[model samples]
Target chain A: MENPCIICVAITGSLPTKANNPAVPVTVAEQVESTQEAFEAGATICHAHVRNDDETPSADPEKFARLKEGLEEHCPGMVIQFSTGGRSGAGKARGGMLSLAPDMASLSVGSNNFPTRVYENPPELVDWLASEMLEYGVKPEVEAFDLSHILKAADMHKKGQIKDTPYVQFVMGVKNAMPVDREVFDFYIKTVKRLFGEDAAWCAAGIGAQQVVLNEWAISSGGHART
Target chain B: MENPCIICVAITGSLPTKANNPAVPVTVAEQVESTQEAFEAGATICHAHVRNDDETPSADPEKFARLKEGLEEHCPGMVIQFSTGGRSGAGKARGGMLSLAPDMASLSVGSNNFPTRVYENPPELVDWLASEMLEYGVKPEVEAFDLSHILKAADMHKKGQIKDTPYVQFVMGVKNAMPVDREVFDFYIKTVKRLFGEDAAWCAAGIGAQQVVLNEWAISSGGHART
Candidate 1:
């Protein structure tokens, strides 16, 4: 049999709000309900970013704790991945929820440009987040915003920063970051195989409209898919 | 005969003070003298950043004007490229010297991590700098710190933000950014050719100890080189 593909669903990202889409889950209860639906639909991993009452992204550990408890009860056996993404918070605040010890957390190993701003991930911050994940026994879903980020993850893994083999997720089609290019996407896969072993697992994610395109590409290319 | 290689000499970068190297040029007069020597020694381009009296990086336009005047008087036809690098200043202050209109200016199309901090080049600031370069009639030498930067340059070119075909410089071996990897180096060249035409000009730059290695690699690969 071929390798089984793990479908990861980002139920609610930091940017999306009720204004953009009414179905975007805002409260902890809504997040758990939405993720349970995704889990029922065959998504084994639920990547989440919690939001405040007014729909602003939040880094509150209290909220994260509640979300974790809810997911554990509602989506039982599904892998819970909290987003340590920049939009929710700044500095170490972004990783404050790592102590909740979710199954996994998204970690950006390097900095890159977003739609309107520079996604500031300093080297010290990256190291600190990786260390936090290590302490909490949280597996990191290495977010590769550009090619160098993959290399950075490899370097970190080699240096004992990342205890296990990094599970890289190639993010493409951001406004000012890596765009959706077939050649670059192929190179990303080749790089992952070259750095990690041939059997190493990897995934890909695309922004907004490119999500479907990337899903097709990843699924057809023998890699896992993220939405 | 093959196309001639354009040797660019970064006489003084943002860092490197007298404590690090006593020979580093700090004042405008010393920079002019150092660049003149480099020009005589087969360097056809001078990449420069001005420093304060205390040897810290400065974005003072008056100093840049004096340096441009000195270089024009001393080196004659050598290409003068002022650096709008992040280390010297923040936001639009980095492009304050664009009105002086040197032959070329170094423009970073995207952001990445430097040794210690996030080298911030926000989207609005990048567009503003590119626009300033266009208004001053100065050709931009796009600095590619990571892979996405090259694609961003191509996108900017298609949008007419960069008036001419971009002359890209691949920068490698920064602590948190792209390292000196031969496979990546070759891929960078291939991507440049694939995006720009096969005949388009490109260059390579390596930091500190990797400088000679990149120069040799670039020279052997038929691309221009910088030190």
Candidate 2:
């Protein structure tokens, strides 16, 4: 038996602009081109967030549609995942693009502290996003910022809110949130396996400079990695 | 060597009015009397929240001051801890009672989802509350609603934001939050001991019906219990 690796590339995050990194892609065309390049380099997943003309984060469904079209045309078969993260929008606006029915969408099941503020994912908003994903036949990639999020995903799955087995992705190294700790990383994997299953598909991503460390750990542990 | 057990009693929580239970105390006088009874019944710590005449939660310092005076007079030598929980107030108003200089105050170092909403403890607000506790010589009983909160308490203690070693309380069984799970509870205790010290004092609280389970776990593990 052989196991295949899934490499996910985040072309543009909700944060970061040309000011932060000159190579960071902002526009739809730039994101598509960059993601296509990454897709050609063994990247099978593209996690994306759109930006406004002034390089600010935007939850505009129109922008998401354009980006989705470009990615489908340029990087065929690459998993396109839209971010329903709080950074891009507030309230229901965050799930506006779920109707596009991307291959997968990031769903935060619980709230946690971020670098400078609370990453507010209220229960109602979480349920609403999960419902939207179910409506559009979008697979939810549960973003586990903390331990309870994994459990919350399990509870949501039991309640028929999340369709299919939840693909959980552990996020670590955010200031005031879960920091980069090997023991915690191990516990997250253990908990995911315990709740989801032994052969459950799980992934991990570390923020900023710690990304490479998480990638190494995930690959070595026979799990997926998101950069 | 004898390990003394500290039983903390929450006389008046932010939620649960007379409608929920006829014995639920709302007025300051009722709170003092209820806490006095609990204190005499082996509960050495009084965790309290003030309520308005309409049974709504209030963060008024005057009400807190009155409660403080009554607790000191009625339940002398018993620890008086104010609740800075989100249900009672928002932003700096949550820490308004720190000026009263109670023995201890509850501090949520990170955010998590509540039953209906996101318990919004923003980074700035958490820092400000910790600073207020430090300034007023009030010991903060860090509320560990989720795993990262315990780690955050350690980080705050290292940075001098928390004046002393944190007394972290694991709060479980809340809807949409960390539920009462034995594995998770054990891991919480392990994490606290790893981050703080092996001899560090810890406590656990379970919402609603699971309170007895958590109390048993805490007592058997040589930790404290909060009711």
Candidate 3:
């Protein structure tokens, strides 16, 4: 039984702020330090989103460059992936950091409801983000909030919008998105294997306290676990 | 196996027009006549969206009232369902005609991608639509565009948002939305039975050329078909 596991660390996502946790890293310097520490703790992938000084989200490529520089200096051999999610920025700004050409970038292939609003990854926007990822030589971890999204990723791969086998990440327990049902969890794993192939790697994520549940599901099921 | 299938006719959806089909029924008179003909042809439910004189979609309750009156007059005893869909209007306007207290209204419980953009039914909007349906004593045909919507409908039913066992409709073959997939189709049926009840009525809809396929699938599978 080959049970090698990949540990991915998402330091700062779009929603969490300093108010949510005093330890939440917002500034580029803080993010770099946080990634360095996470990498030292055996995190192979450092997934990051840059924020402004006032704790507001920012898509500035300069900040990403600085963080990338610091991570290279402090945590060599770490896979750096930028977040192209909707909350950080609107439209093309979400993908502005992709030009820095990190090892990977998160790409949501379809639209689903967030807690408060629609997480809109329109067809053109999804196509544009995939193109940018391709241009920057970055791999996309297709964020699957729903089953259709995994199918959408397959459609994109067939159209050559996504270059490699889409490394899918199942996002569950979001307020209005998919929930953490055991049947759905098992079904997601089956669908991913059916779509991408049995050998392709995948991951699962859950918001807030349910994160541990998804982590256990992914790790125990022979898939990657994201924190 | 006594499978008595319900036949629902969608006379004028938000998108189709006189350009798409010369007999699209723009005015209330046209809709009334068209419903009469469809009813005469053995359609049990008349699922309709009112249009203005120029064939533009309208959420005006006055037109809906007129259409309702005419439908009752012409197609006696036929179930009338209004479209509370986004293309007809924005925000509260989608549910404006629910006050007419038609037998049913189409309600999308979750958001998913449409042909070109996101079909945004935010949580608040979904709540509002469900509440409006409850207030008006109108049953909701839960429009399940994606897998989560069927689950969302279950949640709503448990929470008393939907008064009756939800009748879910599987919408497939939309451009960027859920495409027509057989495995997904079978899973949708299983999900509806698991969530609502084993005997809960369900329907299937396929866009354009695939409508016949969905009709055959639904009819053979003991579910309703939407035309």
lDDT of 2 by residue, A1-227 (tens): 27899999988898898999999999999999999999999999999999999999999999999999999999999999999999899999999999989999999999998888888988998989999999999999999889999999999989899878889999999998999889999999899889888999999999999999999999999789999
Best by DockQ: 1
Task: Give the alpha carbon lDDT tens digit for every residue of B27-134 in model 1.
Answer: 999999999999999999999999999999999999999999999999999999999998899988999999998999999999999989999999999999999999
lDDT of each residue in B96-175, candidate 2, tens digit only = 88999999999999999889988899999999999899899999999999998988999999999998788999999999
Candidate that beats the other on TM-score, 1 or 2, i.e. the better one: 1
Could you give candidate 1's per-residue lDDT for residues A1-227 as a string of tens digits? 47888999998789789999999999999999999988999899989999989999998999999999999999899999999999999999999999999999999999999998899999999999999999999999999999999999999999999988999999999999999999999999999999998988999999989999999999999889998
Could you give the CAPRI-style class of model 3?
A: medium
Among all windows of 10 consecutive residues in model 1 chain B, the one with the lowest summed lDDT is B1-10
Better model by lDDT, 2 or 3? 2
The lDDT for every candidate, in the order shown, is 0.94, 0.92, 0.90
Task: Report the lDDT tens digits of candidate 3 across residue range B32-120.
Answer: 99889989999999999988877888999999999999999999999999999999889988998888899999999888888788888
Off by over 4 Å in 2: none
Which candidate has the top score in TM-score? 1
Using lDDT as the measure, what is the rank order of every candidate, best first?
A: 1, 2, 3
Q: Count clashes in each candidate, considering only residues at least 3 apart in sequence or on different chains.
A: 0, 0, 0
Error of 2 at A31 (Å): 1.4
